[model samples]
Target: MPVLVAVVLVVAGCAAAATRLRVAAPVLLVVVGALAGLVPGVPLVEVEPDWVLLGVLPPLLYSAAVAMPATSFRRELRTISGLSVTLVVVSSLLLGLFFSAALGLDLGWAVALGAIVSPTDAVATAIARRAGVPARVLTLLEGESLLNDATALVLLRSAVAGAGAAVSVGAVALDFVLAVAFAVVIGVVVGRTMLAVRARVADPTVTTLLSFTVPFLAALPAEAVDASGLVAAVVAGLVTGHRAPRVLTPRDRVSDALSWRTVELALEGAVFLVMGLQLEALVVDVRAQHGSLHLVLGVAAVGLALTVAVRAAYVVLLLRSARRRVRHSAERSAWLDEVEQRVERRVQHLPADGDTRAVRRVERFRARVRQARHDLDYVLDERLGPREGVVIVWAGMRGAISLAAAQTLPASTPDRPVLVLVAFTLAGGSLLLQGLTLPALARRLARPATADDRASRTRARMHALLDEVAAREGQDAPRVQVLRAQRTALLDALEEGALDPDAVGHALDVLDAEESGLELRGEGLRTS
Candidate 1:
C-alpha cells in the first residue's frame, strides 16, 4: 500500500511540477514522503545497502551513461577523469583526516567515511538537467558521477582493510587499476555479444527485454570477478547507446527511451522520498545510542563543508586553467584570421588575376584559421567555461548511494549508528540545500541564446532531418524525401531572411506534426 502510494505521489509530484509549480520534483517527493511517514499505519520504507549497490545502481548508471552524449563525454574525458579519480581520492584523504581529528575515529574508519560520501549522486545531475544547465557541463557531471563510484569503492575496500591491518597506497592503486581494466573488458565483450544477439532478434518486445537486462549482464559478471560492477555497467551502456542509433528501428528507439525514462523517474523519486522519510527514524536512533548529538551533527556539518570546499577549489583551478588555454588559442586564431584575410585579399586583387598557387595558398590558410577558431570555441563550450564551472561546483548533492555505502560498513565497526546518521545528514542536507537551489543558479548562469544562433541551429537541424529522410530506401522513400524537401526549402528561406523568426518557428512546428504523422503512417503500413 505504501509503495502504491509512493508511486502515486511520484507521478503526482511530476505532473504538478510540469504543469503548475516551479518546484523540483525531488523536493516535492521528499516532502510527500515525509508527510506520509507521519500518517497512521504507514510503514517505514527501508532500502537495503546491498540492494542499492547491486540492484539499483546498475540500471540507473547504465541509463544515464547510455543517454549521455558520447562526443561531449570524450571531449571532457580529462575533466571527468580528474573529478572521478583524482578528486575522489583527494577528498577522501582530506575528509578522512578531518574525521580522524574531529570525530576521534580510527584512521581507517575515517577514511571509510570519506570514501562513502566522495562521489556526487546521479540525482544531483538530473536536478541540474531540470535546471537547464548546459549539456556539456551536465555530461561532465554525469561522467564523473558514473566513474567515481569505482574509485571510491576501491578506496573503501582499502580503508576497511586498514581498520585491522596495514594497507599500502600501492596496493590500493593496483586494486583500482585491476578493477577498472577487468570491468572494461567484461563490458565490451558483453556489449558486443548483446549487440550480436539483438541483431538476430526482430521483435521489439523481445529486444526491449534484452536491452533491459544489459546492465545486469555487464555488472554481475564483472562483480563476480571482483571487478567494479559500476564501471562495467557504464561501459556497457556507452557501447549499447552508441550502437542504438544504427541497430534499433525508430519504434524500438522510441519505446526504449520511454521505458528507461519511466524507470528513471520512478527510481529517482522513490529513492529521494525513502531517504527523507527515514531521516527522522535515523535521527532518533542516533539519539538513543550512546553518542553525543553534537558529535554526530558536527561531523556531518564539517564533512559537508569540506566536501563543498574541496569541490569548489578543484572546479576553480581546473576551469581557470582551461579558460586560459582556450583564450590563448583564440588569440592565436585571431592573429591567423587577420593574416589569412590579408593574404586572400592581396591574391584576389593582384595584377596576375590567374595566380592559382597564391589563391590556393590563401584558401588553405583561410580553412586553417576557420578550423582553429572552431576548435577554440568547441573547447570552451564543450569542455570547460567559467559560468558552467560555478553551477557544477554547486551541483554536488549526495544521494542514496552514500547512505547505502555507510550502511554497508561491517557490523564490528565503531560508532555505527552515529556514522550512518552523519552520512544520512550529509546526503539529505546536501540534497535540500543544493538540489533545491540548482535550477535558479543554472537559470542565472545560463547564457541566453542569441537570435542568430538559434536560427542557425534550427536550420542545421532541418537539413539533418532532410538528409535522414532522403536516406530511406523503401516504397515510401520517395514520398518522404519529397515532404522533407519542402521542409528543407522552408528552412532555407528562413535562413536566407525571406521569413521572420516567428514565421519560421511556426512553419517548423507544423513540419514537426507532419513528420510525426508520416512516421506513424509508415509504421502502421509496415505492421499491416
Candidate 2:
C-alpha cells in the first residue's frame, strides 16, 4: 500500500511538473521513474504482464475510442488500416529477419520479438495532440494506434505457438479473420445493449458508472473466445461515442467526459512511470542471465531505425494514394452533379400526383446521391499532403504496449531476459528520441495561420444558423427550449456535413452550459 501511494504521488508530481514546464508528461514521468529506479535502496518495481494487458490497456483504449470522432475514423479507415495492419505485418516480418541474422535467434522467436514492438502506442496520440498537429493527421495517428494492437498481438501469439515449426500462413490468416469477426459481433451487441439500458436511466451518476463497465464487458467475452479483446473494446467505444449525442443527456455526456479524462490521465501516467521504473530490473535480469547488455542495446537501436524507416516509407505511399483519391473524388463528384441534374429534369417532367411510390423512390435516390457528394467533399477538404505525412512518420513512437507485450513472452522462451531488455530499450529510446523531438517537428510542419480562416468561416456560419433557429423559436419561448432548438439545428448541420464537427461540438457545449445554468438557477429559487 505504501509503495502504491508513493507511485501515485510520483506520477501526480511528475505530471504537475510537466504541465508547468510545458513538457510531455509521459516523457517526464519516464525520466523521473528511471532516475528513481537507479537510486540506492529503492525497491524494485515489477509489473505483472496481466495487470497491464488486462487492467490498464482496455480502459486506455476505450477512453480514446469514446473520444475519437467517428466521422474521421471512418473517413481515414483505409489509411489507418494500411498503417495498423499492413505496416505492422511487413515491419514484423522484416524486423524478424533482421533480428534472426543480427541476434542469432530462432526465426519464430525473433518474429515474436518483432511483433512485440510493432504497434505504435496510443501515447503517441496524446503527444501529437499536445503538439497541435492538424486534425486529419491526429485522426490517422489515433486510428492507427487504436487498431494496430490487435494485429501485433495476434502475430505474436502465432509466432509463439509455432516457434520451432512451420507456421501455416493460411491458418494464421483464417484465425485473424475469425478473431476480428467475433470481436466485432461482441462489440456491437455490448455497445447497443448498454446504450439501451443507459438510455432508460435518469441519473447522470448511474449512467456514468455504467459507462465504466463498458470496456471490460466488451473485452472479457471476446477474449474468452480467443478473439481480439482490444478490438472489441475499441469498437464498443466508437459505437458509444458516435451515438452518445442522440441517446445520452447533456449532463451524462459531460459527466462521462470529465470522469474518463481523469481516469485516462491517471492510468496513462502510471503506465509510463512503471515503464521507467522497470528498466533497472530488466537490466539486472539481463546481467544475471549472462546476456550482453551492450550488444542488446545495439540491437534495439537497429530495431528503432528499422521501425522509423518502414513507417516513413509507408506514410509517403499513403500520401500519394490520398492525392490520387482527392483527384478521383473530384471527378466523381462532378459526374454525380451531372447525373443529379438530369434526374431532376426527368422528375419535373413527370405528371403531377402520378405514381406516388415512384416519386418517393426518386426522392430517396436523390437523397442517397446528395449524401454521396457530401462524403466526397469531406474527403477533398481533409486531404493529407507531404507536411502531414512527415508528422505522421515521426509521431509513430512505441510506448507502454511494447513493454507490456514484451513481458508477456513465455518464461521458457530462448534468451527471454535479453529479448525483454531489448524491447525496453527500444521503447524507452523511441520515447526519448522521438517523443522529445516531435513537438518541434510538428511546429515546423504546422499549417500556416491562414488555414484557420476556413475554420473561422465555418464557426461563423454555424453560429448564424443557430441564431436563425433561435429567432424562429421567438423570445417568448423558454430559454431551455430555445437552446434545445439551436442544438437540434447544429446537429442536423453536422449530419448533413454542412458544418465542421469541431464547430458543432463547440456549439453543443455552449447550449449545454446555458441549460445547466438555467437548471442551477431554478434549484436555487426553489431552495430559497
Candidate 3:
C-alpha cells in the first residue's frame, strides 16, 4: 500500500513540478520523497541494498551515458577521467581523514565511511544535465558519478574487512583491483550480448526489458566474485548504452533512448523516496540511544565541511592542471589557432554524403573537443571550471547510504553501540539536508543568465513574418504577384499584434511549409 501511494505521489509530484520548477522529473521525485516523509503513519520502508546498488544505479547510469553520443564521451575523456578517478580517490581520503579526526572515530573506520559515500549517484548529475548545464561540464560530472560508485563501494567493502583479521591489506588491494577489472569485463560482456539480442528482437518493449536486466545480471556475477555490484551495474549500462546504436535499427535506437529515460526516471524516484522513508529508522535508532545531539551536529557539520573543502581544492587543482596542459599543447602546436578554425570551417561545409559521413563525423567531434579545450584555456579558466566542479562535488552528497552504514555498524558493547547514534543522525541528516539542497546550491554558483535580447527579437520577428507570410500565401502563391499580395496580407496581420511571441510558433510552422513547398519545386517557387 505504501509503495503504491509512493508511486501515486511520484506521478503527482512530476505534474506539479512541470508547472512550478521547470526542472527535470528526477529532481521533483526526490523532493516528493523527502516531503512525503512528513505524513503520519507513512511507513519509512528500508530499501534493500542489493536493489539500490544493482537495480537502480545501473539503468540510471546507462540512460545518462546513452543520452550522450558515445563520440562526445571519448573526446572528453580527459575531463571525465579527472573527475571520475582522480577526484573521487582524493575526496574519499580527505573526507575520511576529516570525519575520523573531528568525530573522534577510528581513522580506518572513518576512511571506510568516506569510501562508502564517496561516489555521487548519477541521478543528481543526470537531472542537472537535463537542466541546461554545459556539455563538457555535464560530461565531467556524469562520468565522475558513473565510475566512482564502484571505487567507493570497493573501499566500503575493504573498510568492513578491517574489522576482522580474515582479509589482509595486500589481499584487499588485490581484490579491489580484481573487482574493478571484473566489473568492466562483466559490464561489456553483458552489454554486447544484450545489444545483439536487441538487434534480433524487433519488439522495443522486450528489448527495453532486456536492457533493464543486464545490470541485474552483471551485478550478481560481480557480487558472487566479491566485486562491486554498483560498478558491475554501471559498467553494464555504459557498455550497452554505447553499443545499442550499432545493433539496433533507427526505430530501436529511438525506442532505446525513450525507454532508457523512462526506466531511469521511475527508478530514480523510487530510490529517492526510499532514501527519505528509510530516514525514520535512523531517527528512531538515534533517539532511542540517547545520542549526543551536539555530536550528531558536529559530525554532520564535519562531513559536510570536509566534502565541501576537498571538492573545492580538487576542482582548483584539476583546472590548474588542465590549463597548464592546454598552454603547453598550444605552444607545441606552433600557434595553429587560425589553421584549427579553417579545419573546423572546412569540416562544417563538407558535403553530407554517405562516404564522407564518417570522416565528417570525426572532424566535427574533434572540433567540439577542441572548442571545449580552448574555452578551458587561459581565460580565468581556473575560476569557471573549479567553481563548477566543486559545486557538483558537494551535490554528490548521499545520506541514505550513510544511514544504512550506521545501521550496519555493530554494537561495541551492551552499553555502547558501535554505530554511534550521532554518526547515524549525521548520516541521515546529510542525505536529507544536503542531498535535497545540492542542486539549488549548484545552480546558484553558476553564472547569471545573459540577455538573449537580440537573438530573441530576431527569432520573434522571423516567426511573426513566417506565420503571416504562410497564411496569406497558402498553396496558391507560386506567382510573384500572389507572393506580393500574401506579403501585404501578412503585414495587415502583423499590424494587429498577430506577431505576438506565442503566435510566432504558428508562424514558424508556416515557414516550414513554405520551405518544404519550395523544395518540391524549382528556384523562386513560393508557397501560399
Candidate with maximal lDDT: 2
Tens-digit lDDT string for candidate 1 (106-159)? 999999999999988877776776776765677788899989987888888889
Residue pairs clashing, model 1:
none
Better of 2 and 3 by lDDT: 2
Total clashing residue pairs per candidate? 0, 0, 4
User: Which digits, one per residue and each the tens of the lDDT, describe model 2 over residues 388-451?
Assistant: 8988988999988999999999989988988998998998999989988998898888875745
Off by over 4 Å in 1: 1-19, 327-376, 380-383, 449-455, 458-528
| Model 2 ranges off by over 4 Å | 343-367, 523-528
Scored by CA lDDT, what does every candidate get? 0.76, 0.86, 0.59
Q: Is candidate 1 or candidate 2 better by lDDT?
A: 2
lDDT of 2: 0.86
Model 3 ranges with Cα > 4 A deviation: 5-8, 11-15, 22-40, 102-104, 166-170, 335-390, 399-528
RMSD of each: 6.9, 2.8, 10.3
lDDT of 3 by residue, 446-520 (tens): 554421343365467655565566666676655444434544444333323233212332442343345435444
